[model samples]
Target: MSSESTVLIFGGCGFVGFHLVRHFVKTSTFTSVAVVSRSAANHDNHVDGATYHSGDLTDHDSIEQLLLKIKPTIIIHAASPSPVTGTPNEYEHVTIQGTKNLLKIAKRSKDVRALIYISSSALAKGPEHVNLDENHPLANTDPKSSAYARTKALADLMVLEANNPFPFSEPSVKETSWEGHLLTASLRFPIVYGTHDPTTIPGCLSALQKGQIAFQLGSGKNLWDFCSIENVCAAHSLLVQALLNPKRSPGAAKVDGEAFNIHDGSPHLFWEFARTVWKFAGHRPKNDKVTSLPAWFVLALASFLEWGYWIVTLRTKRPYNLGRQQVEYACFTHTYSIAKAKERLEFTPKQDFEGGLKEAVTWSLKQDHWDEKLKHVTLTN
Candidate 1:
């Protein structure tokens, strides 16, 4: 980054966003770093050395003013509703319209030379996704998909399209800082987990504490990619470096107006992830056994349970533990190729899988003050 380089992150207090804040703060590469969060005062997980601001993404007036005041050289948008618990309206405001506002304002915030979006590769297009890459068509408007997925798919496309400095007028041949175009890119991830993680690792450990580890959702052959937090953060840093050195040729073109899948370059059986978490939690296999349940049968059982629960509990915010989406994730192969990330951003996993898991489990349990005995953990809402 140049002497005027300043990085501003939209969701700086979030799981992924905070990790990025820590990454930049620890590395101290940029001249200044700032983060905008919806609620800045409530973050117990916030990192040091980075300034924090409270602001809503939908409020265009405040966001535009903040951009002008900060004059950031690099901007990373990692803000969005929770994928598991978010509603359709939440997706609309934050993922879709919020992204539109960011792009619209970014066009005028000329100091912003680079924009990186943290996106998810967990789009449910079919029963399985094997080695899918940036070329895979997005199902942003699929009526069958969840609102979170639909809107996220749409926002990622928006980020790529906004790469041009002139969206309304004629396009320029090449978009660079000289041309005043925002060099935009998106990094797609699946199942990110590590230290200070509130979801992935904890969910697995919660299942273990509830004595549900041996229950298989479907055939245990399904596979999914998992990336450590350090790996994901490393990819973001590499992209920042690449975007700053865009004149590096063939590799440089890969940074702008592109989306890249990022992961550990290895895929494991779905339940294998949970089993590994249990191993780190001072547990030994009593037996190599699991109770298998057919996926179709589970889905049928879930549909009936969902209707009855709605009638009984009337829980409008439905988060059925055994819903169709959960079943598919546990029974399908959802793996992606990180070849583009490697070739374009020169990205690779900074932490080894099992080693990283050990570090995560150790840090997470310490936070809970567990005394070598597994304690009860709430797995869901």
Candidate 2:
């Protein structure tokens, strides 16, 4: 990479995006840093080291202009429908359409170097298995599913195939004529939890506050690889910086099209993780009885609530909101192996499950967000 290399990150306002933006901006390696989001959020303005551009991923014109203006060498497309937000179609629009827009932009950006997509491990083939790697097929036939998973799977395919160095079909629209191949890396992340976690933390807290969480979801033995937001950001940065290194990178001849399971390398059961939060928050499990809700019932309830809201509001909004998905997902076991990333990207998670949860709980207390009664819980032990 040249000293003139510019890096542009899409969707830098959301949780994982915020963490990535902070990491890239502070690195001081790039000539300039730019962030493009649907709108300029409060946190966007506060990113001292980067320039923030207001642009929506679904808007082709905005994306074109943003690409033209920034002329980035490294593009990090982290913008998409968050796992907890948007209906099924909305997920398609953001993940698929947003990616198409970015790819179009990348085709135009003559100086572009690498494009790294932060995808989800929720796209894994084995929602029932313990530990999965990149080779596992996606759970394409899961009857009980969320739109988020489906769209991510689609987008991931688009990305991998888009790499010209690979033997995939070329997109009809090439915004700009390309000189060489565009390196694409798909980093699949697991149940990411950390500071600025607008969705996960709040939903969990709401259930606890309402006394709705009685027993662990399922048998509570299903393992999940819960990653820290900071660690996720760190690994991404390492990958980006490595792309600038000629000896390390796959070079122009290589597609650099690879998928790596990104996690903290440790799997924790749903009950085990929940118990940690309860202890830290100074609360006892609301319901001691472990009752099992069949997967069919959970999905049915979720669909009913989702459709009911759509009917009532005349909008495709989920009725139970983000909480419904959390309840359902908590029952399943999901884990991934990050060994590839650790070896290739020189990545190591800085925060483990225990430390990350503790920090998150502390931040919640500072915000006065948690139930006041549980504030005195012995967190240190």
Give the clashing pairs for model 2: 282-377
* Model 2, backbone clash pairs (residues 3+ apart or across chains), number: 1
lDDT of each: 0.79, 0.71
| Native-to-model Cα distance after best TM-score fit, residue 89 in candidate 2, in Å | 2.6
lDDT (Cα) of model 1: 0.79
Please give, for residues 1-381, the per-residue lDDT of candidate 2 as tens digits: 565667888888877887777777787767788888877655533477888888888999878887878888888888887676567777878888989878766865676757889898887654464677787877555654556777788788777776654123444222333435676888898777887777666666655566555544466767778888877877777777665554542333332677877878777777676667655666654435666666667656766777676788776666554235665566677777777787777788765688889888767756645756444443322
Candidate 1 regions exceeding 4 Å error are 165-180, 246-252, 303-316, 370-381
What is the per-residue lDDT of model 1 for residues 1-381, given as tens digits with 9 covering 90 to 100? 556578999998888888999999899888788999988878876887888888888999999999988888889999988876565677899999999998888877767877999998875365578989888877664676656667888999999988853332333322434335787899899988888777777777767777787689889998889888888888988888877763445423457888989888888888888888888887677578788999889877766765575567554454646655566678878999988888777776664888888888888778855423375443222
* Model 2 ranges off by over 4 Å: 41-45, 139-144, 165-180, 248-255, 284-300, 307-315, 321-328, 371-381
- For all predicted structures, in order, the TM-scores are 0.89, 0.85
Candidate with the greatest TM-score versus the true structure: 1
Worst 10 residues of 2 by lDDT: 166-175
